[model samples]
Target chain A: MHEMGIALEIHRVCREAVAGRGPGRIEKVRVAVGELSAIEPDLLRFAWEAVTRETTDEGAALEIEWHRTEQVCPSCGPVPDRAPGTWLRLCPSCGGPLELRGGTELEVLDLVFAAEDDPPGPGGDEPGEESA
Target chain B: MSSDERDGRRVTRDFVRIRKSALAANDRVAGELRDRFRDAGTLVLNLVSAPGSGKTTLLEQTVRRLRDELSLGVLEGDVATELDAERIRALGVPARQIVTGGACHLESRIVRRALEEAEFPPLDILFIENVGNLVCPTSYDLGEDFKVALVSVPEGDDKPFKYPGIFRRALIAVVTKVDLLPHFSFDLDRVRERVATLNPAARFVAVSSTTGEGVDAWCDLLREALAAKREGRPWP
Candidate 1:
C-alpha cells in the first residue's frame, strides 16, 4: 500500500514536530486525513506501527481526524451529504454540476511528548521507565 | 521516574502543535520545481493511470503530433524495467525512465533527481508519466502544471466513479481506446456525468491512439497549456 510511504512521511513530520525537544517519548500523533486524500487510515496506522516499532515513538497512538469533502452544486451551493464517499450524480436542488469542497487534507495536527527529567532509559516513563 | 508530581524528577508531558502537511517537504520541493519550470517556459504534465491504459502509446502519438512544433521530453516512471522509456525513445523523444523499484508513486524528490541528472534540450513540454496506479500517484505532486488521469474503454467507464481520488485530483480525464468502445460496455456519457459530479472542472477528452482519433484535441489541449504557461495565464 502507498500508505506505507505516507506513514513514513507522517513519521518524518512527527520527528520534525518533536525535533530539538530534548529526550522524550512521543506518546501520540494526531493527524487529519481527508476522504479525498486517498490515504487509508487503518493502513496508515498499521504502517506507523512498523515505522515506529523500535524507535522512541514505539506504541505511539496515531489519532486520525477524518474529514469529508462535501459536494456543492455550483448553482445551488452547499448540498448536504448523502454518504461519506458517494456523491449524487447531479445536484438534488439544482441541475448544475456538483463540485467538491475541501477534503484533500493530509496534515499532522499535533503530538504528545513525554520528556524525561532525568535521562534516557530502556523503556518509556509511562510503561516501564519507573519499573518495580 | 516520577514519584507523584512532587519533584522536578517527574516526567513532563507537553502537547506540541505543529500543523503541517504530511507532505510538507515534498510540497516545498514541488513549489520550487514549479517556479523553475515556469521560468524555463515548460509545461509539465503528470500523466497517471492504471497499467496498460495506453499512456505510452498516447505519449508516442502526442510526440509525433507535436514534436516538430514543440521540444518535448518524457520522464517515464515504472515499478521496474526500462520498457516504457525504450518505447518512447523509439519515437525520437528524450525519455528518461525512472524505475521506482516497486514504489507506487513518483515523489517530487525523485522528479527533482531526474531533472538534475537528465539532459533534455529546453523542452516546451515534459510529460512525467507516473508509475501506473491511480491511488498513490494522486497524493504526490511532482510539480506538474496539471495531472491527467487516463482510463481505457476496456477498463470500463465507471473507473472515474470508482477512483474518485484520482478523478478529483486530475485536471483532465482521458478515456483511451474509444475505438474499442464498440466491443466494450463502457458509456462515455456516464463517465462524463460521473466525473463531473466528482470534479466539475476536470475536462474530459476521449481518444484512441490506435485510430489517431481525438489526438488532435489532446495535442490542442497541450498547446493551450503551453500558451497559458508562456502567457502566465491559467488553463482555460
Candidate 2:
C-alpha cells in the first residue's frame, strides 16, 4: 500500500545517481529487500510501473534481491539457511534458543543503465531505440 | 489497484529494471535527524500504541511529576486536532500539535519542524506522541533516541505478537491501563514472553495513571535514560 511512496524514492535516487551520465536510458535497477522490511515485492513492482510510466527510466526492469533474516543459535552460532517467513525458535541440532541477528534492511543497492559510451554531441552516431 | 486481474477489473503493466530502493532519500534525512537528536543532549522518546493506549495521559502524569527537575516538550501527532497540545499546555509544558493531514505515521521532517518551532530552553526530554497506529508508525524513525510502545490491558495480550515489529523496535515496553486488570482477562506472562522473543533486551514497566501504580518507576526510568543521554552513556 505504501509502495507508491517507495517507488517515488527509488525514482528520485536513480535520477540523482545517473544524472551526470551521458544521454542514455536506464535498463535495470537492483534493489535488496530484507525479510523483516515489511515490503511486499509484488506491490512494489506494480507501484514501480505506475511511477515510471512516463519517466526516462520507463520500461526499466526492477530486479529484487530478497534477503532473509539471519538467526543465531546459542549453540550453533549462525544458522546457515532458513526459509523466509518461517519462524524457527530453537536450534535444530542442540535445541538452543535462536536469536534474530539481521534482515531488517530496506535499501537500494545499485542501478544499471545503458549510458552513451561516446558523448551525445554533434559527432555522435544515433542509436536506434529498442524495447523488450 | 488490482494489478493481477485486468478485464476492466485490473491491469498488469510491466516495469523495466530500475532497481532502486524507494526509501533512500528518507533514510538520508532520517540519519541526519538521528544525529541531531544525539547531539542535542536530549532523550527523544516516540510513544506508539493503539488509539486508547493512554499515551497522552502518561505524558501528562510525567510532566506533573518531573516538570521541576526536567525541561520537557511534547510533539503530539494526530490526523487533526490541537486538543492534545492544549492538554499538555494545561500542565504548563511547552507543547506543539502536529496535524499530519491524513498521514498515518510521523516522519522525521515533521518532528524536525516541531523541534524548530518548540521553544523549550535547554530541554532534557522530548516526547513525540505518534499517531495512534500500530502498523504504519512502526516503519518510521522520528529522530527519537528510543521508542516507547504502550499496550493497554483491554487491547489484549496478543497485540505484541500481532504487531511484533513495533514491540521489536521499542527500547521500553509499557503496559498501560493496568487498573482494569481485575476486569480484563489478559495473560501477563504471555505478553511478556512474546515481547521478550521479539526484543530480548527491552525493559518492561506496568503502570496505571489513575491508580499511580507504576508512575514513579516509569518516571524514574525516563529520568535515568535522560541522565544517561547527558553523560554520553548507552541507553538502557
Candidate 3:
C-alpha cells in the first residue's frame, strides 16, 4: 500500500532525471531493492503500473535488482551456513557481534528511455523550458 | 541495455545512470527534523507495532512515571480518531493527534507539522506512536532516536520471525502485555533469542502496562537513551 507513494517518488525522480537529460518518455527504470528495505517487489511493480497508467510514461517498466544482506563478524570474516534474511547475533567462531553489510539499499541505479518525437535542434530541449 | 532507431532523427533508446535513493525526499525531511530535535536536546522515539500491541497503553504508563521527572510530549498517529491523543492529554501531557485518515502509516511531513503545532517546551523526549502497523512505519524514519518495536503476548512468539524486517531494524523489541503471559503459551526466551539473532544490538523488554510490571526497566531504557542524547553519547 505504501509502495504507491514510493512509486510516485520514483516517477518524480525519473522525470527529473529525464528533464535534465532530454525530452523522452521513460521506458524502463532499474532499481536496487534490498531485503531489509521494507519493500515488496511485486507490490512496487503493481504500484508503478497503477501510477503510470494514462501518463506519457505509461507501460514503463520497473526492474528491480534484489540485494541480500551479508553477515560479517569483526573478528571472523563472513559467517557461513546462516540463512538468508536472518541475522546472526554473534560470530559462531569468535563470539563477537556481527556487522551487516549491504541489504538496506533502495536506490535507483539507471533508466532506459526512448527518445520522444521532437528533438530540439542542438540542445535536446525546448527553448522556454530550458534550465539555466 | 539494448536500443534501436525510432524515426532516424533521435536515438530511439538511451540509458542514463541515476544513482540515488528512492526515499531521498523522506529521508531528507527526517534528517532535518533530527537536526532540529538534536539542537533542542530532545530525544525522539518512534514506536512501531501491530494493531493490538499496547503502544498507547505503554505511553500512558510512561507519562505517569516520567511526567514529574522530565518534560514529555506525544504525537499520536492513527488512521482516524483523536482517541489516543485524548488519552495522553488526559494525563496532563501536551499531546498532538495526527489523524492520518486513511493512510496506513505516518510520514515525516506530518510529524513535522504535528511538532510545529505542538510548540511545546524543550521536551526531554517526544514519543511518536506510529499507526498500528509493523511494516510501512518501519520504512519511514521519523527522525526518532530509537525505533521501538512492540509485540504483544497474544500476538504470539513467532512475530520476530514473521516480520523480521521490523525487528531487524528496531533498536528495541518490547513484548507487551506480559501480565497475561500465564494464559498464553508465548515463550519469552525464544522470542528474545530470535530478536537477538535478527538484531544483535536490540534490547528486549517484557512489559505489562496493565499491571505496571517491567515498567521500571522500561523507564530505565528511556532514561538511558535520554541521557545518551543529552550527553552526546552514541547509544546502542
Candidate 4:
C-alpha cells in the first residue's frame, strides 16, 4: 500500500545522508520497524528494491529490526500473561489499568557504505608491507 | 598487477548511525500546524473510518446542532471528487475538498495547502474528514487535537479486533447507524469491550444520524473538548 511512499522517503533520506559524507555506494541500510508502525517490513523491502533499481545505491540490502510494544500495569508492574501480539485492558493479577510503552517507531538506525577510494591491493605485497 | 595485488587492497566500509524517524518532515509540519491551531484557540478533530460509514452524514448533523453555539469549518478528504465538501458547504459552513488522487491517507503538507486554500475564517472548531480508510491514515499526523474513529452498525463489532491500529490510536470511537440496531446483529457492549482492550483511554459514543439518538451526547463531548483546548487543560 503506502510502502512505496515509505521506500521513497527512505531513499531520499539515505541519499541526503550519503551525499553529506562523501562518494560511496551504500552496502546496507538498517531500519527499526515497530509493531505499531503499521509498516509491513516485507512489502517495504520489495518497494525499496523497486525504488532503488536504477539509483546509485542499487542492490543495497535493507535490514529491518523489529520492535515490540510492552504493556505495563500500575499495580502489577509489567504484565506477564499478555502475549506479544495480544492486548489486555486490565491487569490480570490486580485489575489495574495497563499502559503501553515503546513501539510506534519507524526510524533509520544506520547506514553502511563502501568507500570508493579503496582499490585492490598491489600484487606480491607482503602481509606486513605498507602501501602509500 | 598480479592477483595478490588485487587481493591485498583493503576496502573501506563506513557505518554511519542516524537513528532518525522516517516521518520526521511530516511530523514537523504537523507540529507547526498544531501550534497554529493552539494560537487561534481552535479545536481540531480528525475523523477517520471506512467508506460508507456515515461520516459525512454524522458531520452534517453535528454541524446543524452546533452551528449556533460555535463557528465551524471542515476539510474533506477523498481520492477524487468534491462531493463531501459540497455537502458540508450546502450547510453554509466553510468547507474545502482535498482530492488526494490515489493517496490513501492525508499527509500534513497537503492539509496545510488545503487549509490555506479554504481561507477559513476564525472558527471555534475545524474538522478534517480523512479519506475513508482505517489503516494508512492511522500512521499520519494531521495536527488534530484528537482522532475519532467511526464504525457503522452493519460493519460488525469485530472491527476493533480486526483493525486495531486505528482503534489503538484514536482518542474516541463512535458507533454510527445505531438506529438500525434492531435490523443488524451488532453487539454494542462487545464493541466497547474490544475497543477498550486496544485503547484503554479512549471514549466511545453511539449515535444514529437518522433518529438523532446520541447526537446530543456527541455534541456535548465535543463542547467539552473545545473548552479543554481553549483553557489549555489536558483533554479528558
Off by more than 4 A, model 2: A78-96, A116-132, B1-22
lDDT of 2 by residue, B1-236 (tens): 01232222222222334444466555567788778777878788999998889999999999999999888989999999899999999999999999988877888877877777876676788899999988667777777888898999999988876776688789899999999999999987778777776777888899999999999999999988988988989978
lDDT of every predicted structure (CA atoms): 0.87, 0.79, 0.88, 0.87
Provide the lowest-lDDT 10-residue window in model 1 chain B.
B1-10
Q: Put down candidate 1 lDDT per residue, B122-192, tens digits, no spaces.
A: 99999999999989999888899999999999999879867888999888889999999989888999998
TM-score pick, better of 2 and 4: 4
Candidate 1, residues A1-132, lDDT tens digits: the string is: 798888888889888877897877888899999988988899999999999999988999999999888877767888874776577887787676677788899999998887766743568455323422
TM-score of chain A of each: 0.83, 0.80, 0.80, 0.83
Give the least accurate 10-residue stretch of model 3 chain B, judged by summed lDDT: B1-10
Task: Give the per-residue lDDT of model 3 (tens digit) for B1-236.
Answer: 34334664444466789998898888899999999999999999999999979999999999999999999999999999999999999999999999998998988988998988988888989999999998888789889997999999999998997887788888888999999899999999999988887888899999999999998899999999889988999887
Q: Assess candidate 2 and give its lDDT.
A: 0.79
Q: What DockQ do the predictions score, one after another?
A: 0.46, 0.17, 0.38, 0.45
Point out the worst 10-residue segment of candidate 4 chain A by lDDT. A123-132
What would the TM-scores of all predictions be? 0.93, 0.83, 0.91, 0.91
Model 3 alpha-carbon miss at residue A2, Å? 1.0
lDDT of 2 at B102: 84
How close is chain A of candidate 2 to the true chain A, as a TM-score?
A: 0.80
Model 3, A20-126: lDDT tens digits are 55566898999999888889999999999999999989999999999987889888798887786556668899898777777788898999877654544765543
Better of 2 and 3 by TM-score: 3
lDDT of 2 by residue, A56-132 (tens): 78998888888776778877888777765455556788887778776676677776665434334568545433434
Instruction: Score chain A of model 4 by TM-score against the reference chain A.
Output: 0.83
